[model samples]
Target: MTKPRVLLADDHRMVAEGLKSLLAEEFELAGIVEDGLALVKAARELNPDAIVADISMPNLTGIDALVQLKRDNPQVRVVFLTMHRNPAYARRALQIGALGFVLKHSAPAELVLAVRAALEGRTFIAPDLAAEVFRTPAKKEAGPAEALTSRQREILQLLAQGHSAKQIGAALNLSARTVEDHKYRLMETLGIENNAELIHFAIKHGLAP
Candidate 1:
């Protein structure tokens, strides 16, 4: 049988290039994209058998792109390439019609396995991440980040976009002080401080590209 055709999407140039070469050894690398909107457009244009995209991408986000792709091309398979080990994200990816959610920390072999499995109508999650996820300490039940409300997550995303506290407040319809409060809380909860750290965190977890 012929190998599968795969489209790889990630904002990190080095990562996208590296994965493309690695996966190319085993499959037909249909294409690669650097942004979420480009990913959507590439998928529509290329019509690859499967698409593997990072969760956080510029413009539309990986999840949002996946949603649109599924709507427009229901027969296409989607596999999320994420750094987030959070079970919540895994569940959300599934809810959005992704065929699989594979954490980036998994062995390169695992990624290959996930790609082929997804092609064959099977779902795969990184084994180690899956284990740790289920073992989330009950005592640590509410992860500090989890304590923040949905509004806070929204603010954090904007902050990573280089928005000033006042700008974030204006966009979210809150006072600058409120934005500051949320920023302080997010730093405390996510164990990150300053805008730089927040951006690093978001990109690390595939929440930003």
Candidate 2:
């Protein structure tokens, strides 16, 4: 039988290498990308059956990238493998259509299972997080972070990573002035007054790299 195609995305080379080894036996390794932007590009080009990604990648976060990917391909299967143990992150990921949320520390034993489940159209949350992730109602009012547009969230992630307006503009194909305008607008929307608070908010809400 042809193995299921899998794409791996993680900023940490060592972690990606290890995941590559773990998944290679059961699935075909379609590609490896180091950041969320590259993951989005590779997923488009490769059309892998499933993607194993890290949530806190640079340029764009995995959740944000998935949001964009799902816009074009809603059936895209993704399993997030990350160190973040916060149930809120897992909740947000699943709410956004991720099929699996596995913690990095438990990956050796759980990742393949999660990937398989996702490919089979099943949802899997790490055992440690499953209880808390599902304890709350499925629907909730949008939080402050959820209120930001996708472009604004992208710019916020870049800003939190210490990129300047010019660099961000270059990356997003906007002018520096436009990038600055976006910065100010997002700040006002979030009710934050300064860069330090913005960075703190980003980190707190899982928007930071």
Candidate 3:
């Protein structure tokens, strides 16, 4: 019988190594990836049966990565491995079509079981997160800092911290006009009437310093 194949994605090298050690015995490790995009690329190329991902990875978050990878291959299952014990994120992950979420603090044995369950077409949320999601609601869908794409969130955060448009442009390798356009669009999306409101909103949302 062929073992299940999986791709590992996480930013922490030691964590990845530890997981690889635990999984290699029961699974055929396909390839290891360090970022969400690489995980997506590997998933499309390797077409592995499963993916175990860390949620806070760079370039793309694990949830965003799952969204993209499932777009590419709906049949492949994903299990999020995170240190977060937040019921909200766990439920959101399920709502977003993830098959399972394994808490990093979960026993190593549970990780193995989570993988097996996912491979067998079963959903496996962590035992501790078995509560109704109390996810924050009523936040504006488009915040003042949301004009930037996933890649631009960090940049916008800096801008909110009082960086000049030229400084932001230089730092991001974008033209000043481009940064201004982003600012304009961000304000429009958030329905802010002026730069003062924009800055206020950004600061309130912790996007600004």
Please report, in order, the local distance difference test score of every candidate based on alpha carbons: 0.78, 0.92, 0.77
Native-to-model Cα distance after best TM-score fit, residue 174 in candidate 3, in Å:
12
Question: Among these predicted structures, which one has the highest TM-score?
Answer: 2
CA shift of 151, model 2, Å: 1.0
lDDT of 2 by residue, 39-111 (tens): 9889999999999999999999999999988997999999999988989889889989999999988847699
Q: After superposing candidate 3 on the true structure, give the runs of residues whose Cα lies further than 4 Å from its correct spot.
A: 132-184, 191-209
Rank the models by TM-score, top first.
Answer: 2, 3, 1
Q: How many clashes (backbone atoms < 3 Å, residues ≥3 apart in a chain or on different chains) does model 2 have?
A: 0
Give the winner by TM-score: 1 or 3.
3
Error of 1 at 166 (Å): 21
User: Residues 121-162, candidate 1, lDDT per residue (tens digit)?
Assistant: 887878876665445455535545446565666676667777
The residue ranges of model 2 lying beyond 4 angstroms of the native Cα positions read 137-142
**Global fold similarity of model 1 (TM-score):** 0.65
lDDT of 3 by residue, 1-209 (tens): 89989889998989999999999889999889997668888898998989999887754568767877767777879999998786766876887788889899898988898899999989887777755443455565654443546445544455656778888787567888988888777767677778677767755654432
**Runs of candidate 1 exceeding 4 Å displacement:** 131-209
TM-scores for all candidates?
0.65, 0.93, 0.72
Task: Quote the lDDT for 136 in model 2.
Answer: 67
